[model samples]
Target: MKLQKLTGVWIPLVSIFFGLLAGAIIMLLFGYNPVAGYIALWNGAFEEPYYTGETIRLITPYILSGLAVAFAFRTGLLNIGVEGQVLVGWLASVWIGLAFNLPMIIHLPLAIIAAIIAGGLWGFIPGYLKAKFHVHEVIITIMMNYVALYSVNAIIRNVLTDGSERTEHVAETASLKVEWLTQLMPNSNVHAGIILAVGAALFYWYFIEKTKYGFELKAVGYNSYASEYAGMSVKRNIMVSMAISGGFAGLAGAMEGIGNFGYMTLNNGFTNIGFDGIAIALLGGNTAVGVVMAAGLFGVLKNGALNMPLSAGVPHELVDIITALIIFFVAASYMIILFREKLTNIFNNVKTKLQKGRGK
Candidate 1:
């Protein structure tokens, strides 16, 4: 157990080390000082209270988004439609927020529920198709992303436009902004969404690790045919898993619509949060705790990248390169394992030789 824990910790650390090493090599080849660039990156992300709060704020949605992908992965599904779900959720949340006026106690939950339902419905389509007809989910999801993009744009232009390319701001009751938090973290957009995200993570961990339904989902993931043969309802599990995943993604959108931006605007392209979630999920090993930590790391890199070019004369794109390298190292983890095993064997052989000489 100790060995397993150690390996788990070291693997991610090693991947990060190699990723940074590769980035440094690239920077050297391009006539940049990696040391200065990294220092600037660190300072940009952590130098001020405002930057810290911003990083935390960014981490909020990333946590939920990463959970969405991680949940789907644990259920043996790849939910590429998270982007679409987020879009639909954002629209639904903003629409409801603008359409109603109630006390914060009621309005906030209502808007959140709207977002969740919208995202679930969007996820349901692909889930239903995949379960009922064995259709490929990846293709359906990719196509649905475009559908969501155009659909939301049309709605904004034709229905919600009021001389702008966005919907009206939501009422204070529906907003997730905490005035005290904003005041406390000056120049930061801190909101109550971080609390929600933490709650979601706890819920995810509990449900997946402690619930019977979660066991069923994992069973199906491990072997759907075997699970079905054992009388588990594979189709139902698939739909449920997808809906839950979509709900998480929807909550992520809610953070943006009601917490960060307080409105829905025309999206010319994918927001990239869902794509980033993919990397976050992979880095976290599709686990809840892992996801949260990975999200924080990503949030730092993203927020820090903004100041790298200005502060260190380094291209911000280097962060992207580092991120890609990290993912590549993770994907090619077998190489790391092989290298470790070779080192272990060599050490053992040398130890044996030394002991034999001593005996002689």
Candidate 2:
């Protein structure tokens, strides 16, 4: 069991190391100093207190988005519409925050709940279609992404516009900002959302690892037909799984609306956070701890990329290339395993021959 757990951890770490090595090789080929570039990247992400806080702020939404993808993957579903869910959730939360004048205790939670419900409803459509009509979730979700983008834009234009591309700022009571935290890390956007993100990760770990429903979910994932034979309602599980998955993504949007941005603005394109969550989920092996770690790594990369060109004379696109390489290596993990096994066999044979010669 210990060895298996170690392997799980090591595989992703090894993939990351190889990805960096590939990036370094590319830098060398381009006459860039890989060491200096990495040093600058590290400094940009962690050298200052403000940068550290900024990284954490970025990580907050990433953690939830990653959890959203990971949860669906674990349940044998692919939630490709997390981007749409996030957009709608952002609008829902921001609308509630602006519309209400309640106290902090009530207003804050209400906005969050609205976001979750909006995202859940969005997910439910595809889930229901898949369950009732055997429709492919991927296609429905892709279509929903456009629907969400256009619908939210229309709604913003018609109802929420304040003579600007964004809605009015959320009320102070609905905000997640902690004045002390911001003061502590000057110029950083740290907020209570980080706490919520950590809490959500813990809750997800407990729910998926220690509960009976979690087992049912996993059982269905492993084999839906067998789970149905054993009396589990696969359809119900699918819907619930998607709802929960979407709720996580919605929470990510809530963090942006109520914590980071304090408003929803017109987006000409997807925020890309939800799409990045797919990479996070893959790099994380769809595990809670892995997701958190992967999110942090990605946060650092994104935050530091801005400084790469100025500080190290390396193009910021190098980070994107590195990320793509990491994903490639992760996707080709079976090759890594086969290579390891072959090396292990070679070492064993060599050891056996040396021992026989010594004994003779």
Candidate 3:
């Protein structure tokens, strides 16, 4: 049990270490002061209450996006349409936020539910087509990303506003920005979304690790045909998995619309949160606890990178390079496993020789 726990952490830790080392080497080659750069990063992420709060805010959506991807993976699907799901979810949430005049207690939950349902329905399209028509989800999901991008822009221009570039700000009743949290982390855009994020993580842990449905999902993931043979509803499970994955992704969109931005605007491009979730989920080994930690790591790296040029005369883009290296290392973890085994064997051989010498 101990070894299994250690193994779960080892791959990501080694990947992060080598990635940072390689980043330092690159900085050296480019005549940049790596130590100063690192110091600046550390300060940016944790130097004051504001930066700390910002990092936490950044982590909020990442956790949801990672959970979205990880949950789908657990159920034999790759939900690449999370970007679309987030777009629809954001629009839906903000629409509810603007269109409603209810009390805070009612308005907030209604907006959240709207977002979840919108995103869930968006995901259902691809899952249904895949399950019923035997179409590949990846192709449909990728195409839907462009559809989402254009559709959001059109909706903003034609429907949401009076042909304006952005929607009106959400009502305070529907907003996630609470007075207490703002006072707690003054001058930061952090909001109550962190609470939602943490709660969602707990939900993910319980659902994916503690429930019978989770086992059936994993079983379907391993082999759909076999799961069906064992009397599981493969098609129903697939659709349910995608919908749930998208529901999580939709909540991530709410973190942006109602929490951070408080409105929806014309999106000229993808939010990239869904794509980043893929990397986050991969690094996290598809585990709930691992996803939370990985989200924190990414949050720090991204938030801290903003300070690099100002503090150390280093380009912030180096963070992207380091992130890519870390992911590459993760992808090559088999080599790390082999290296560890070789070292273990060598250590055993040396211990055996020393024991023989002592006996002789």
On a 0 to 100 scale, what is the lDDT of residue 62 in model 1? 94
Residue-level lDDT of model 2, residues 81-163, one tens digit each, is: 99999898889999999998999999999999999899888888898888889898889988998999989988888889844
Rate residue 1 of model 2 by lDDT: 83
TM-score for each of the candidates: 0.91, 0.92, 0.92
Residue 352 error for model 3, in Å?
24
Segments of candidate 2 deviating more than 4 angstroms: 1-3, 335-360
Root-mean-square deviation (CA) per prediction = 5.1, 4.9, 5.1
Against the true structure, candidate 3 reaches a TM-score of: 0.92
**C-alpha lDDT score of every prediction, in listed order:** 0.90, 0.90, 0.90
TM-score of 2: 0.92
lDDT per residue as tens, model 1, 1-360:
897666656666678889999999999999999999999888888888888888888999999999999999999999998988899889989988998989999999999999999998899889999899998888998899899999999988888775479888999999999878888778887789999999999999999989999999989999999999999999999989989999999999999999989998888789998889899998888888889998998999999988899999999999999999998988788476778889999999999999999999
In angstroms, the error of model 3 at 8 is 2.3
